[model samples]
Target: MNPCDTMLADDEAVIRALLNEVPFNGWTRTALRRALAACNRDPDDAAFLFPGGAADMIETWACLADRDMEAAALAADLAAYRTPARVRAIISLRFEQNRPHRDAIRRAIAVLALPQNAKRAATITARTVDSIWHAAGDRSADFAWYTKRALLGGVYTSTLLFWLRDTSDTDEDTIAFLDRRLNNVATIGKTRKAITDKRPKLRIPMPGFMRTWAERA
Candidate 1:
């Protein structure tokens, strides 16, 4: 691999390793530096690797999760399912993959939700939904592309937050919540389409003299 790719991979590894300490250290730069030091790497490298500190770590964590989700999607046999089913499967796989590290994930989410990190959070969320769509075989390049991603981003973010707080066995409650959110998105899309279809077409108006003549006749 090229130097840039290799460096990025190394940085990602370091950040991921730091996550094991997040639940205790609170997802701060100090904890990341401590993690780097524990690995016998220069603790100062934390600044160079993640300039935004905890916020950067949070974004990178989501990216790693996205990559894991894509890999799982690629390995699975999803040919039998339709588009929506494929999407649901990808999300389910993503959640399952992160279940082991939910505490760290929750900490990251809290960091991302901070006011200073809002932009990074939105960007990361957008990237995640886009990646999920790509994994689900969505290749649309039209106006619907933006709308589809917007709708899915909302659903994914809400479902993720819900899942983070869920306590049901095997995450059954979170899965049900996800289904409901997806259905809501589908319902909104259908309603918008129906409204568009039923809208009355505009007509050219005739002159007042012609209208009076026709009425008199």
Candidate 2:
């Protein structure tokens, strides 16, 4: 992947620079304008920079997190780990890297979780998991591609929520929670594969009535 492709634009960097001010000003267009003032940028540029207002800021923040996660993964030595371990490592790196920005992240999550931003939120979650998979050296091009990312999405989101609320001083509790979620996903995948492999494939269709009754059973 070209690192430049994920590089933040000047406007995005400006928005990120204002995260510390988010709690004070909130993630509004007004907040952005005020932030621009502090940065010696034109407040009128806010519209040009984030036409979607807070939604844009939140979405950009998510994208930035994904890019940072990928960069960290690239710098780390994860070659020795298996696929599951590597996935967990990449996700853990993301949370750890953003630890200092937890408040900003929490506020971003609130903005993304709004009813109007549901689709963007889902897109951001999907993209983050996709980046993690790529960084973990996954080369799947078939059904596993979707399944793996989908599973990780669930794991990562749950673990992030846990981390945000976790009171553990060293964050060991959050790490354990993340590990359990990943382990559960692995177990479920193995169990599903075993079940699928053991089930006989039927070339002939059963009678419609019988199939309907079987489905109810």
Best model number under TM-score:
2
Worst 10 residues of 1 by lDDT: 1-10
Tens-digit per-residue lDDT, 137-157, candidate 1: 989875567668889998998
CA error at residue 107 for candidate 2, angstroms: 1.6
Give the TM-score of each candidate.
Answer: 0.84, 0.85
What are the lDDT figures for the candidates, one per model? 0.80, 0.79
Clashes of each: 0, 0
Off by over 4 Å in 2: 1-8, 201-217
Clashes of 2: 0
Q: After superposition, how far is residue 113 of candidate 2 from its true place, in Å?
A: 1.8
In model 1, where do residues sit more than 4 Å from their true spots?
Answer: 1-7, 37-40, 199-217
- Top model number, lDDT: 1
